[model samples]
Target: MLASHEHYRAAVAQLNSYAHAYYVLDDPIASDEEYDILYHELKAYEHAHPDHIAPDSPTQRVGGSVLESFEKHTHLQRMWSLDDVFDIAELEEWVARIHKSYPNAHFTCSPKFDGASLNLCYENGVLVSAATRGDGIIGEEVLHNAKTIASIPLTIPHKSTIEIRGEVVIPKEDFARLNAARTKQNLPLFANPRNAAAGSLRQLDSSITAERRLLFVPWGLGFVREALSQSFYESMRAIERFGFYAPKILEAQSTQEIHAYYEQIQQERENFSMMLDGMVVMVDDFALQERLGWTIKSPRFACAYKFPAVEKITKILSITNQVGRTGVITPVAELEPVEIEGATISRASLYNYTDIEKKDIRIGDCVIIIRSGDVIPKIIKPIESRRDGSQTPIAPPTHCPECGCALVQEEVILRCCNLSCKARIVESIIYFASKRALNIDGLGEKIITQLYEEGKIASIIDLYALSVEDLLELEGFKDKKAANLITAIAATKHIALWRFINALGITHIGEWASKELDRRFGLACFAKSYEEIIGIVGFGQEMAESFVEFSAVNHELISRLLALIEPLPTGSAVGSNMDSAMDSSGGDFASSAKRPLENLTFVITGTLSVPRDDMRERLENLGARVSGSVSKKTDYVLCGSDAGSKEQKARELGVKIITELDLEKLIGF
Candidate 1:
């Protein structure tokens, strides 16, 4: 007879599986938390049965896998990342700069999304597409799943063209249920709701994609023909008009008031369903945004003040290990799943043995796990209170988990067999075919995992050897997908030399390295001459040394890789202005332009009726950027009544001090 505890175990298993279908898959097969009660019951059983263990346990796997690749797509606008402010001082400094610019600069503070960043596209006010923040310029489209989000309205009131940008996130309770199901199914679980939603949104199939209950909150508009409001709140109401969930805005009159708003958000962390990573403070006026302008990346006007992450102390139940794409062995702590920042965190990465030693963490010892800002939970410290003699030190692995190859300990890292490890074969294949690299359209990580699990394809070299029969048998793949994968791989055979260089995933070389190489050498010569690279601009001793190390490390593979990508084209022949930037001196533009304010340095001090940043920008547009602190080089100080240090400094330096009115006259208003 099955024990009463076994009944609870079975119930828990059913609940978690259904939860996965509903939460992870976004296909709700059962009522919400129908599985939760079962999960709770199973936990009760586990508390009773410390001896009985389930191997295919949802309780086991760490959620979220780093995909080998993402398919590339053009962003409607672009998914620009927000510039960060570390502290309140930076925020205040930003406010002060604004005060100098626009006299009537009243600002609003909004809860900065603590979820996945996205760029959403709509045509005729109908939701059409969504993409991840891959780079600022390009992202992968996952519109099918994004459409299922009720909060992300399918149609808007506007008849004219419109597009918006926002984030997609999984709510906390839903995240827990999905994880419980994965635990029961013994499938790998998600690390957090944010990452989980991101992974789900990227799925290729519309049906598979629709399963994650993602919420899209339109933070700001993208490409809209007409202005919604004169200010930021009006824009929200406008987006709301189009049937999208607009974020709550906290309008503040002063910088002090803005700080008060952020403090309130911090105090109300758990009050909201979607997590609040930080506070995004911005001036409301559209004219002001135009006046302030932008940096190359972000708008000059806004800032995200990230909240101090919710942290809690928990016991390190035990230690475990996981093999990564490179076959590097990493230590992970199995913590007693504790609540912090609206989610239950059971695991934290120990990076390597170096990390293990640095923290001096031990099994059965108490440790503090911190979830700060946008999280990948980190270990803060050991509690020392729970240090019992029952704790044991975990030794680093001697062999690769998958291939059984001997492992080696580098200075701070642990490595398995260099070229031949199975972990690497899968990872390299994935990287070799990623969006920025070769971009094999149908080649998802799930497929690669299956191929690796089934022993159908072994190495990236083996990917060339894959036949029609090799891909057809994988679950969800069909005749068309197999053919498409094959065609994509064939097309990838003739790709950019920079893409080839980048696909190799060298230790420190990134997109920048490959791009730099493209500027110096075209594809054909690049493959042959990359080894000769040393002492170029930005190419330093360490980069060259790593290249030399890599040559020795992957000699045979590199040779094969060269053979595949050699005849392919290089990227654009446009030599980077960086290649020989000294060849032309455009510094003469500032010196050449007979500016009205050429030699004059203006330091704006004290509050004006307008934000100083706006005032500064206008002065700059007329060709005079404001100086922050007063110095001997300063030509004038724009003083307000409370002007303290800067006014005093200007006086000591014998500098001309101007009022806001005088300052405007100098800029030739």
Candidate 2:
């Protein structure tokens, strides 16, 4: 019995070490399969000897208790915010103020994650309760929801009582997926990840929190019964050793070092999984921090050096209606050229006619433009304070700007309704020839516009009918360039099934949905019943209905395009080792389904020699599903230069990771 107890303790220690390495360090010391084996053994031993099982066991992380409602709890320590510094001069002043008290003070800088703050209390190395940072002293109890976070360890190595303060955030990739799911359900989408995280945590049901996939990252100590280290850096390292994620810390001894560190973090913020608004600079020495003390609201020992705001004030020159590929006329704001967050802004999307009327936006009004992350510049609101009486209210267009077709108002959007509208045809062809779709190189927007205006290309099918001689009639066409474009158009005659489906530009059907549809139904997707289409995982009733509606409206167009384009045989859809067997048999159709990647899901990250879209196409062509985020369901991750959090998450989840060269080997590229 003693030997069995010793073995159980050993298993728990081993599992804790693996969790610390995977979660805190972003590195894995053991394979997931190996860890699982050990974890199961531990569970079995505990099951056999329940009396000997410790409360701090890793198996106790997932709680089964459900709560009726959240209760209010008082915090043991007050949670304080840090003073903000917007520029280098302000940061220098802060450093000077701190140095006056502690002449030899050094600082530790870490990311100021934009997220909801939570305070977690641990007793006897076991997590007892959790609460939000409400009013600094009192907070709503959320222990039930807190247990759902996988990154928050339910048990730690510390035997003393301790309270940890950390931020809860949803990663950017996960946020997109959550929003997409919400859109399919016709629910209002959360504006950003921070909002999503906060809403998820405040849910009455713990299951809702689990589904949102929130992560908790420790930043500072709230209270501790026993001191572990004398320096802040050392204390953070100790916290990490207890299996909690701590942000990357950089030590700076001088103002120049601090400035360089802040700049480095700002440049790399986008690559981080969580949203970061600034860097938190704090005195590294515990004694110095204690001596410096705090003000009524903020601590004097720490200050936040924030990055320049992505939002800027810009003037709207005019509002123009742009006809999309789907014939929906979207209002776009043409802005006076202004720089925001390193990019020059000239145009911002105003969404639809309803958005303009609701915001009271008008031509010649000054507007607040925001360029957050990789998203396009968007007008948040008009600066009505600076508006003069000369501002003209934008009226909805009565006719199509390009072809003079009568506009039809459908719900919140205005549409051209005419299939033969020149702008609609041009945009459709351009999208069909885009890199993510057919990948027809040399066919750009300008060239497509010229071809449509000259009546040489009226539809997507007309591109296949064009010859070098037909293109030579245009003003700027040269023999070599025209031949290259024709050749490029011909090369796109054969495409993957998913790309062909996405190229159709059906409403609510994006590249990801197209891939899912192809994986579920393959070539027979168009013929599937609405029930069958909606039954597929990750697809909803709205998408299935949209697909049926689109097919009914454009059946003839689809048939004509199918006649011109040959969709290459997919491994799962066609049933067999189609690539190799068909090649050996001189393109003979096979009978048996043999998809090597039938159940595989891949995620691509970082820069590759070929565009990421092209790489995704190649993988999907072989019957694989590509997702944006890494989860347990992910089969593999294709990593390239500068791969960031996705790669790290893959390692933590024990998903197979491959390089671009490795991917080529798998697909026989």
Candidate 3:
């Protein structure tokens, strides 16, 4: 037993040293195979003597507990974002502003990792908790998941309380491997490493997070009980000594040096193990940073210089028409295969015929395709100089590609008026089973297409009628798979009213609008007239008219669908028959004395501490209407940090501006 105890201690010490060498110093004394063999021996010993295992042991990273939901935690110090500078001139202006305050200021520039921001709090040299940057002040505690990251040390060398701010990212190689595994399991692929890292780090299951292999790179310090140095660069180096992956820093004394560093980082961005969106330049002196302080949303001491968007030239092989669930026909350009930012691209959206004509995009023409941030890849413009006489002009199709019906043009959009268009039907069914709608697991696009092609399912209603026996006949379905699919379909019979409304594929009605409609009218939304819908504060004339037309044409179909599914109450409306109550009250919705803020219209703008969508929902639940823009009729504007032109326009129109604190007071929260 004494020998076992000594061996355990030695293993833990060796593993911690190896981790520091590999993660912090980027140098290793032992090969990966030797490390793995030693790690397994330590894990086996720990498993046999669980009570004897140390808290800081490397084997203790994967916690056994699963969280139901993340709890809100108030940050000890505010985590301010950095102001962005898009061009060199803006960066120069930022430098000049900083120099005006500190004439001898020097800066430290480092890559701004493109991933989820995390705050790690350590007490007495041991990590106690980790939280996400939820609202700068309040964050979600994700300690269980955060402990799984190999780069985050469970115990540091410094025996003091400290808070480290950094980014949690999935390395590019791990991200690709994860996506490949997901593809094999028929799960949706993560769009990028940032998204994958964010999703993985926020998992409710700590085991899943541990499996994801996320890495943490500390870039800034939130607070330290014991000061290591007065300079930020020296403090970062001190942090590195405590076993953290501190970002590589470059010192710049002038704007030219800063620009040169930025260019060098941008050129070498693809070579990094993780994704980087930009570079952050901060004044190196802590005293100067304190003097500079902060603006409303970001720090005045530091600024981010974003790299130019990734663009690649590819030839458009052909243009094809894709019909949406609403029967709107969109033009898609099939491009020659090209790789950009670690992703392979073979297609880009042409939007509509109007966009094609405006850009003069043609087949066989070399076009500039760009992927900016999270936006979809799009064609910037056709390289007219490279276009030869062999290039052909793309013409809009006069007939629907799926149903051979006449196509109708509505302003800039083209649509197939045929309700029975196969493409439209397939798309609607796909959407009905989507995560936002009925949430029927195992009903993916391939299966839906197969069912449609085999004439087994015709509409959304047909999904409820599927049985295990019917699914067994499909190509990929074994007995267990068939039963599971049937069970999944059955589980979706009771769905949220907003999801049901959105699943119907009503023109101009999205998930948010559906929720609003369900809130104001409830089950009686089916009986609302065009004028009554238009009377709603947020509903536009076009949306109202579209709803009325759809209801008039498909009343029986809608009634049949509603009978097959039960809508869960939203709790947003006081009664289930709000339309009947309005009718009885002579269509005067203002007569309801129970409704607070009933007649008020609000416009929300800028970055709120809380999510904007959450704030909007809270307001709507209190019987207030939220609009997308500021207008003369707007009663108030809920302004947050960096409130832009909307706040200015509200002031000009005599609309009251309210802060987040004011909103809380008004809502009596």
Candidate 4:
């Protein structure tokens, strides 16, 4: 019995050491097989000699039963919140204040982990309790759930009663996987990783928390009976040696160093595995920290220099539908103007009626708007908890709000089929003058709107008839602006055929489709039958039917536009101008040597050597059809670093995958 107990004790220690190396140090000392064998052996011994089981044994991490409710736990040392500093000026002011008290004080800077604060109390080297930082003084006990975190040590070398405070975070990958699992089970998705980590830690069942794969990153101590080190940075290092995962800390003596580090972190934050809201700047010397003292709610010694918020909570004042150039109705949330990352976001796209229904977004509901650098502002989810009895459900409109035309359902979206709808006409004109369509430089949406509203232009055809005098009648239209606009309009009179087709704003036909249709029919698409359009490769029934219907309905308009403009056949080698557009690769597709990728379909994904659009253009110029998605029909998937779902789909379909170098070789470049 004694030998078995000794063996069990040895096995437990070995497994814990392996776990510390693998989870905390990110270096595995033992293979999975070795660890599993020992873990099971310890479990078996504990099963036979149940009374001999240690509280800190690896098996105890996930062996707890579900709790009915969380018990209140009072922290021995209060967990103080850090004062926030938004900009460098605010940080400087904060440092100046700190300098007044401790002039020689140096700081320890670490990532302000955007997660739930946890206070873990260890008595005699064994973790006895863990709790959430509810009100800083007292918190809800979550010891069982806390134990499930692999990075959190169940036992340490410190025998004194110590209260270590840390942030419990889920790595971005693990959070994604958790959300995916929840999606499979039809659960409400978490808004972000911080929410996911907080929710996981609060689970009634420890097993649920264990499944989340949470990480406990110790930032500082609440209280320690014995000091590890006099310096804060050295103390954190000592904690790391005692089996805790210490976050990377930078020692900064001056405010300039902190600002430089902040800038560096801002550039590299995206590369981090977890979300970092900002950096926590704390006095490195424990004596200085103590001397600086505390405020009513936070420590005077430490300040959180926060990055501009990527996610902000705002109230949805109303839900409105926006009409696109193609008359596709998109539900847009008119939000209470909130600033996110230095931009005032007053509107967010709900995408469609289906998305509105899926997300249960309602008028008067508080919603979370997510906007990262350059990404379009979007309503992620409505905060259902904040909903009151006054909030109303958003329903799809039966008729077009602009023209009062009956709306047509197309899959998940509603479309305004009326070609003469005022909104549709206005948007179409804007789209026609867009860079991709006509390459019209001075004609923007605002300019087009002004022209439409002032009765200067009604349709795409009317744009060509505009005079400088007509534009001068509207607001903000000077002589130079009007001339520029007229010149820009006149410039598109002799554009490529593809641009003309794209400018038409036909339903289901985008730039790529326009290019494909141009390649196949050139100037003869208007005369082509529905069956012929359908017979074209990659042209589905919807696109074919839309083209046929559009051609039939707008035959007069198209004929008049054709007479007004000289649309050169872009894909064919006709004039020097037309040849220049087709020979983008400095080679002729109509050459005796056939285009290598002719009739092949390629799907491009991830961060390629060049821009994605450039790569797609290159592939298209080589006579290969570049698709947005991957399927069995795809001949090859041109992939690069960090390829997402499309690459995975290609793998599943057994489509040939090639890198940028391989593509260069294949193209004989």
TM-score of each: 0.61, 0.49, 0.72, 0.50
**Which candidate, 2 or 3, has the higher lDDT?**
3
- Residue 217 lDDT (model 3): 90
Q: What Cα-based lDDT does every candidate model obtain?
A: 0.68, 0.79, 0.81, 0.82
Question: 67-165 in candidate 3: lDDT tens per residue?
Answer: 757899878888988888988999989999988878899999999898999999989888998999998888999999988888898888777888988
TM-score of 3: 0.72
- Where is model 1 more than 4 Å wrong at Cα? 1-73, 315-318, 354-366, 382-412, 431-447, 460-669
Q: lDDT by residue for model 4 over 557-611, one digit each (tens)?
A: 8888988887877544443343356345666443324567877899998788777
* Order by TM-score, highest first: 3, 1, 4, 2
lDDT of 1: 0.68
RMSD of 2: 23.6
Worst 10 residues of 4 by lDDT: 571-580
Write down the worst ten-residue block by lDDT for model 2.
582-591
The predicted structure with the larger TM-score, 2 or 3, is 3
Candidate 2: tens digits of C-alpha lDDT, residues 605-637? 877887786666556545577888899989899
Each candidate: RMSD: 16.7, 23.6, 7.1, 26.1
Q: Cα miss at 242, model 4 (Å)?
A: 1.0
